[model samples]
Target: MSEIKKSVFDAMPQDLSDEFFELIAGNDEVKIERIISRGHTSPETGWYDQAQHEWVIVLQGEGEITFADGRIIKLGVGEHINIPAHCKHKVSWTKPDEETVWLAVFYS
Candidate 1:
């Protein structure tokens, strides 16, 4: 077989602009998704009752994650956190003038 030589930043699909979501692997036992999202948030919007556990990290920019219970967490470049399944959370606030790049991995 031939070698596949390409950088992750270079090989990201051209058609998928605004954000990059690559499904790296999946199976009955586990699933993995590599994502690079920039400025992807609903301003003034919130989320609730997530169905799956997710581990999220900030690749760049600045933002805050909030939960229904009034828990707040701040994320910046190179920071990360884990959210349990069914945890009601949302992007409470983000830098309006900057892009927030996030990497999220989800699993059951």
Candidate 2:
């Protein structure tokens, strides 16, 4: 058997003026996505209320997340968290000098 080789750090756009998202895989019940951020944050007046549960990991660099109720979560490399469906959250900050890479799994 042959192994399929891929790299999570590949294809990063040189111009990181905005965050980048790549959909790696998806099925009826689950979706895998990769997000690259360099000093990115959610809109000032908005929060993400997702319909599906999301499990996210910081693969590189660091980031901070804020919940609607004022709770804050800090994540560095290899750190992860599970967000329940309909939980309101927003990304507060990401490392500015380097890319903060994240792997997010969404499931119903």
Candidate 3:
């Protein structure tokens, strides 16, 4: 069989006015996605409380995540964080001058 190869940095969007999310791969119990953010943040009154656990890593640039418990986590290039299911969180900040590339994996 032939091999399938793809680069995470390929096809990056130029319009950074809004964050970009693309599904890289997935199955019934897991999903892998590529997210690109540039000065993007969750709504002031919104938080992500997902049913599945999530592990995210910053591939480029940087970002900050704020938890409902008033804790903030900063992720730089090559940095990662694991968020348990039902944990409320929101992205507070991202590099405004450049794109912050993130690789996220969600699983049960």
lDDT of 2: 0.95
Q: Could you give candidate 3's per-residue lDDT for residues 6-104 as a string of tens digits?
A: 889999998878899999889999999999999999999979999999999999999999999999999999999999999999999999999999999
Ranking by TM-score: 3, 2, 1
Rank the candidate models, highest lDDT first: 3, 2, 1
After superposing candidate 3 on the true structure, give the runs of residues whose Cα lies further than 4 Å from its correct spot: none
The TM-score obtained by model 2 is 0.95
* Model 1 agreement with the true structure over 21-103: per-residue lDDT tens digits: 67655666456665554455444555756667888887667878888789999999889999999998887666655556566
Over 1-108, each residue of candidate 2 has an lDDT whose tens digit, in order, gives 556788899888898898999998889899999999999999999899999999999999999999999999999999999999999999999999999999999999
- Shift in Å, residue 74, candidate 2: 0.3
Lowest lDDT 10-residue stretch of candidate 1: 8-17
Question: What value of lDDT does candidate 3 attain over all alpha carbons?
Answer: 0.96
- Model 3, 64: alpha-carbon shift in Å? 0.2
Name model 1 segments beyond 4 Å from true. 1-40, 43-46
